[model samples]
Target: MPTDADDRVYYVISDLHVGGDEQLGEVEALPELLAFLERLERTDENAELIINGDAFGLWEITSVEGTDKFDYLTDTYPRLFEQLRTTGDDVTITLLPGNHDHELAAYDEYVDRFAAYNVTLVQDDSFTRRVGDRVVYFEHGHQQDPNNRIEDWGNPDASPLGYYYNTLVTSRAGQLSDRGRYNWLKDVQAVTPTERMPVWLLSKYFYREMNPLLRYALVPFLLLFNVSAVLAVLAGLSLADIWSTPVEEGTAFLGQFGAAGTALWFLLAVNVAIAGLLLLVGIPLYFLRRDVRKTIDRFGVFETTLTVDAEEPYEKAARERFAADEETAIYCYGHTHRPALSEVDGGVLVNSGTWLKRLHRRDGAIGVLPPVFYPSYQLCAVRIAAEADSVAVEFEEIRKPSPSTEELTLTERLLTLGRKPDPELPDRAEIPNGRSATPPEPAE
Candidate 1:
């Protein structure tokens, strides 16, 4: 850490993923972002805002290539560019390239263009910032990910697996999002762990795109699937004379309701029949899927876990950096979109999370419905600076209401009632002059 730079405060954020064609261009927190910049402009402290990586979604821009992507971004988001200019005038703003915006390093035009707007495009994969006597290493964190890692940092043709993902799926969704009954497909980026895409698509189709009549008609069967399965088992046991009493009692109990009793019996019978058929078919499909997965694994075709077990790689990387540079007190990054603050080898590790609407997977309270992706915002800026004799780190959450009412279906809301993401971040984390103790718990 540099001694002369001790007085300056640093604000870090990443994975804003701005700029794409059509629905991908929609930044739900645009107002919040502008307000954050405006607040920075009015601050009295000496501050530098470091966008660690992925300030733009250059990879998702199917409409343009190379420098034209920046032009498209500036044209599409004039207000954002204008705000960046305004904020840059007041606060030092710096940007580094992530996998999504690797083009920032590839094209030399981006440096001058970003400079015109007051953002210093670093054109590198990683860099270090100093706060007091401690150093914080900043990277996009994609280098740890096999699918997104770029072997050649500035090569224009170096496309990783993640590049194809954005191009084929995310960009395509953006272009066709409006064609859906609800513009839900645009949120494909919010679905973490790329493996969840198929399930997410199914959930969206059922809750948002499926015809209302068909959905409503099938709701009863889906909701009572478990009950039906249990009843089928009970029926089989009764036929075998192992559990005959319960069935007789249940039938007699319903028989007292006359016509309604008849209807109830009919529904139950249909449910049992459907359950039996499903069991027979699902058994074969389950084994088939297992076999396919095993074959794929054997061949090592798709060996990525996407977002699963996201922390280990970054944590290991952070520890390596700490070992390599003993002066380093913080390792800051964003890529997993999961914000965390934890002690690592006498130092602190920080993930700056994303400004994009986060999708928290919520399973059905009962039955076998597809997991509902509840939407919320964890928009935050990590501030690190000198506080007296110690180096201090604090998280500042940009408050935004969960878009549940607007984004979720009534069925989804009911199924996931009283359940929504409320992530906690340590209000303040500090490393003492000697770096001997663990940080305290978050403030109440």
Candidate 2:
């Protein structure tokens, strides 16, 4: 059993694309993050910080060129690095290269740049560390994705959409310049539309279709019509009232009753018709839309999966080569932007989730401004503690609060945005590493 003194905690974070197109939320979270680092400095002295991957959106800047990328990195990432350095002077910072920043795969440049900042660059897909008696493994989880799997041939370089876009269509420049060699193929092929067309079209369609003003305008009419329709149905059912009343009373009652019946019946029919229409037409449309979305999502999944799997052949070879060596407890990785903690036959696996804020389709019906939900802002970490004859693993979230609307002033907004970073709380820890360093006992 490993002693308590040997146990250690490590913080893992990923996908902090410091200088990408969507920098708003990250920028907002910066001050709070700085403060959080200060707090960490004051507190957790022994913990190492592992930045899983995609720290920089290098692919985005490749076409743009010099100084811009450097300026952006210096302006944003230095604050983050400086704080980490100040908080944990002895702390080792391990950075795994991810797809977005695949340049890290070329280790020399990364080592040179990040070493000065006290960040160690890890070029491999998997890394292992020991705390007490526990062996922990880390990898970015993209290997599990199908689309980006490295096994896929001729995928584009590290950019997110570029892989699928390039794979499915020939570049215009290639078509034009390589005419002689590819002329036969080009002559038979259909020209691909702009890569961005589908996304742009969907965004525009959703914005106009889901407009709140239209929903609001229809709401009152819908309500009034429904009410009238209900009353009309009730009146129609009350034929006795029409037949039994005196002349004067019957005349007045019949007029009101008939009107109500007519209104009620009209509304009921309209609602039924609408519902029927929806069932017959809207449901199919809904399914079609979902299918389209899934198709697009699958493209992304394929690229991610392919890239990871391609790298896996080498990993598998290494594992086999070292099969007779010392048994390892866990395997953890975070380069693929997927979060997972699972026990495997030989070891445990951990994937630190990404810090990239995923852009979801905006829905205008919910608010004055369209609501853009960022799906991937979560920051996660793991703790490994020594138990009797084993080690326990745990996960945590480093949550930050949303900015309050009451604080509208510039100073107030900054202050609100700068609230203390929440306590790094674990979600689940204590799932034992399944396969022990020792070989399993033979069948009893």
- How does each model score on lDDT? 0.87, 0.49
C-alpha TM-scores of all predictions = 0.92, 0.58
Poorly placed runs, candidate 1 (over 4 Å): 1-4, 257-263, 277-303, 440-444
Predicted model with the maximum TM-score: 1
lDDT of 1 by residue, 1-444 (tens): 112465899999999999886899998888999999999988887889999898899889998888998889888889989999998987889999999999889989889999999998998899998777778899999998988999999999889988998988889999999999999899988888778889999999999999988988888778799999988888888999998987899999999999999999999999998997888889899999999999999997765765435788888998899999988889999998887888889999888999988888888888788889999988999998887878888899899998999988898989887887677766578898786326758532
lDDT of 1: 0.87
lDDT of 1 at 392: 86
Model 1 steric clash total: 0
Model 1 CA lDDT for position 165: 84
